[model samples]
Target: MNLVERDEQESELERIWSECGAGKGSVVLLEGSGGSGKTELLHQAAERARRGGGLVLHAGCSPAESALPFGVLGQLFSSVPAVEGPLARLQAPNSPLAAEAAPHDPARGAVAIGPQLALLLNEVTATLLELSAAKPVFIGVDTVRHADAQSLACLLYLVRRTGAARVMAVLTDDTAAHRSPFRTELLDQPHTRRVPLAPLAEAEITALLARQLERDEAERLAGEFHTLSGGNLLLLRALLEDHLACGGVRKDGYGRAVL
Candidate 1:
């Protein structure tokens, strides 16, 4: 499917590139309701960073991992090679203690792994700094509001340290449901920028539908789809799929329904 309405976000991403290119690493906190295209914007930014010869690392936060120390760090460790050595040194091979100390069961594992996890995360931060020295690094964290305390600590540490490092961090959070600690931390930092994603405008929504359907069909469906989804991209797409399945936008019909 074509990306119908991300021109403004694209421009912001380009502006971030210019800032980073000038040796200013920025943290962009993107806040919106669920299905509001925050993740899509991050994906676009990551793609752009990759094309510009920057390293991109993406991680998602889960409620199951909320108590696990370094849960988000572990997710990030699996992606970027720059931190492999430090993480390896921090974690042992097939150790029962390590397995038992997993982040998901932090209450049971915290006594055994808490201190080690903190030290490991510190090492991870240092490693990231080392990697950033060679080239710009882009880190995308999704659902930051659901992130664990330890993971949030690590993120805050990164923001403080990035003033001297070539790393740009992008985070997405559901603003309607929960507030993000990271967002507060970012706002205090002069280098960080917060971008709130609003619902797509009617014209943009029309353009989006047009990319998926012919002109007349797009015009007809766009209004209905916008009303149903409130211009939330994910819901809009789902509604479109439902409409298509119901033959609401047939190739050869103006107002025909299959059922």
Candidate 2:
């Protein structure tokens, strides 16, 4: 997909990165429903970061590992240049920073997060600032709603102090999904922006199809797809693939579907 109806979203990310490169850090919350191209937009921003000689780190939050503390951060910086020392060691299972405990009292049940975790958090914050001073560092996460509590805590801590450093963090998740309790750290934080995505427009869908099909054929199918898909490109692509597999999408002399 050629980034239909997402110019503003992508441009916002660029603006943030440009500001970060100038020693003004920023954060962006990319909100969208499933298959709304949130991940694609992140990748696009990452490409720009890379081209600008900035370091790009990306992690995807998954249900299978959502229970693991600092799991998203581990995956994010595991291969990156900086933060391979204390921050890297903190991700290990045996590290004291990965401790887990739950008190009997529900009010005190904020266990698994203890003094050791505070040290790790400080280490992450310092490392980010130190690295950002040398080169722009862009951190992006997808499906952020599923991120573990520990990762979110460390990120919130970083967000507070990143305003003066050359760093930018981008987080995204399904717009229809309930907000994660962990995101409270990001709430009311300065320099934070939320971007919600809407479904593609009829013209955008037609242009998307025209990339492969002739204009007349693309316009004809776009009308049906716009209605059938409710402007959802993910569903439209799936339906299109199935239609092609069943030989129902064959073109006539005028390039319209034979049916």
Best by TM-score: 2
What is the clash count for each candidate, in the order shown? 1, 1
| TM-score on alpha carbons, each prediction | 0.78, 0.82
Task: Using lDDT, give the best candidate's number.
Answer: 2
Q: Where does candidate 2 stray beyond 4 Å? A: 80-82, 92-94, 100-113, 240-259
Residue by residue across 44-134, what tens digits does model 1's lDDT show? 8888889899888888888887755556766776777767775565444553334423444333212223565556656777888888778
lDDT of 2: 0.74
**Worst window of 10 by summed lDDT in candidate 1:** 250-259
Candidate 1: lDDT of 244? 67
Name the runs in model 1 displaced over 4 angstroms: 79-82, 88-123, 249-259
True lDDT of residue 67, candidate 2: 74
How big is the positional error of residue 191 in model 1, measured in Å on the Cα after superposition?
1.4
| Local distance difference test, each candidate | 0.71, 0.74
Instruction: Give each prediction's root-mean-square deviation over alpha carbons.
Output: 5.6, 5.1
